[model samples]
Target: MTGPDKDEAVERAELLLALRKRGIRDRLVMRAFEQVPRERFVEPVFRNLAWNDQALPVDCGQTISQPTVLALMTTALELEGTHTVLEIGTGTGYYAAILGHIAGHVVTLERFRTLAEAAARRIGSLGLANVEVFLADGRLGYRARAPFDRIVLGAAVEEVPSALFDQLAPNGILVAPVGPPEGTQALMRYRRGPEGLEQRELGLVRFVPMLSGVAAVL
Candidate 1:
């Protein structure tokens, strides 16, 4: 297909520019976000609005995270190539793809079997072999791949899951949106230091509630 029209291109440019405006200055993070086509991750009906700085609905009541929020969460983690990352809530597998681009290996968990399968296919088709998608309750983390160098939750949880904290390696980082069920969510960054786990509230943000157990329908 032809490239987006001038107005559409301007909108797309503004999206990334807005992210930079919000202090998502990490070059690697920005490049990865630009490289991965957000348009491909959403349904065809929403493709025209893909570049907008807004969440669009996908299958199974899940929404593709807004790009600014995604960049914020990713930049907070500060991933490196050697880090083995575990991602919770593999919605559309877009965030996992970004993590896979920066980290050594990314093990992403999805509670819905259908989402997991779709993510697996998307990642494979993209030729991202470093990513492994799992259909499991992400709140438990992945014991088989314990000792993650970094853990990122795509959905918001009321509290950090103890199991996830245990799975983090010494000096590892965990970034998530934590707070009440409503709109008041804080983007928190937890570091498992030699002394103990330390938490810092980065900024206010919002995300879909992180749920336990698989989707009953799917």
Candidate 2:
């Protein structure tokens, strides 16, 4: 491959190195990031920004979060290959693809019908059979598939929904950006152990607010 394909390959390699230098320490998470091509999830006009450490606009006024944030949150989960994962905020289904690559199965939720449908197509295009995308309210989670071994909330929320907590399996790890909708939010990791729920902050990040109810047609 020559021209743009070659340039993108070069840029993707450099981006992986940059992510490592920035503290993406989990080997599995890093490998998943390495394997999932970011360009496929972004619009053609924004393909050039796919490898950058920045979020890009997507359908439904949402954004595909930057790779750094995705990697950090994923690493915090300490995800195991056998774990079943639930991702709240499918966006472009980018991170879900990464999770699918690293975990046993991934169920991602998006409030927007269009984004959910598009993301499903994107994941399917990659031939990731372990990943499933749904059009639903992320706040409620996918109840039929409860007790997820790992849960990642892609959007920031002022309060972590109790329903999601109920969906987390015992000894599971759930990572989310929790704080006010505006300004910076704490990237929190919650571990549900036999003793109780343990909490820790991964770092700070800015994400679009996680909304309730399904989005109406635009």
Candidate 3:
């Protein structure tokens, strides 16, 4: 391989090893992380650190989540090949691209129009046909395409929004970070069943706050 390709390969390998050491055991989740180039989702200034296990700022004051958190959330979702996913924060579109690799379809919503447009362009350039990016209020969820088999929120909130639960299909799984935006949050998973929504706390995490309404920026 060329020098850059070899370096990227090495970085990817090391990253996968680190994730495995951190107890990320799902093969599909690992493969998705391996396949998606994190550099493509980060700002040019932070491209060199793309493979590092840390969140990095993108446009619109948002951040692409750390690889470990993304993997954990993906694992919690328990996605199947046929599942359609609703992603609450598109950010740099990196996570949505990863979801595209594992799920049948991904509908991602971003409050910032600029971020949504950039994410759409990036996902399109990658030819990730299964993923769609939209500029909208994520808290409201996408009712037009209600009944998603899987839903993931990249931002943190005090609690899971009821609107999202209404959009989840029976037996669907919704994974999100729940807590105050300034402090540590719990990575939670909610499964819709015959009885109701079943909740599980995966781990503590930190993420940006889940905001309401669309961004005012043109």
lDDT of each: 0.88, 0.89, 0.91
Alpha-carbon TM-score of each model against the true structure? 0.93, 0.95, 0.95
lDDT of 3 at 15: 84
**So what's the TM-score on candidate 3?**
0.95
lDDT of 2 at 16: 82
For residues 21-72, what per-residue lDDT tens digits would candidate 2 score against the true structure?
8798788887899899998998898877788878999888889998888888
Model 3 residue 122 CA deviation (Å) reads 0.8
Candidate 2 colliding pairs: none
The lDDT-based order of candidates, best leading, equals 3, 2, 1
User: lDDT tens digits, residues 1-218, model 1?
Assistant: 22345366676678889899989999889888877777778888878788888888888878899899889889989899899999999989988998888889999999988888988988888889999999889999999999999999988899999999999999999998999867969999999887898999988887889888988355
lDDT of 2 at 23: 91
* Model 1 misplaced regions, further than 4 Å: 1-11
By TM-score, the better pick of 1 and 3 is: 3
User: Which 10 residues in a row give candidate 1 its minimum summed lDDT?
Assistant: 1-10
Q: State which candidate has the highest lDDT.
A: 3
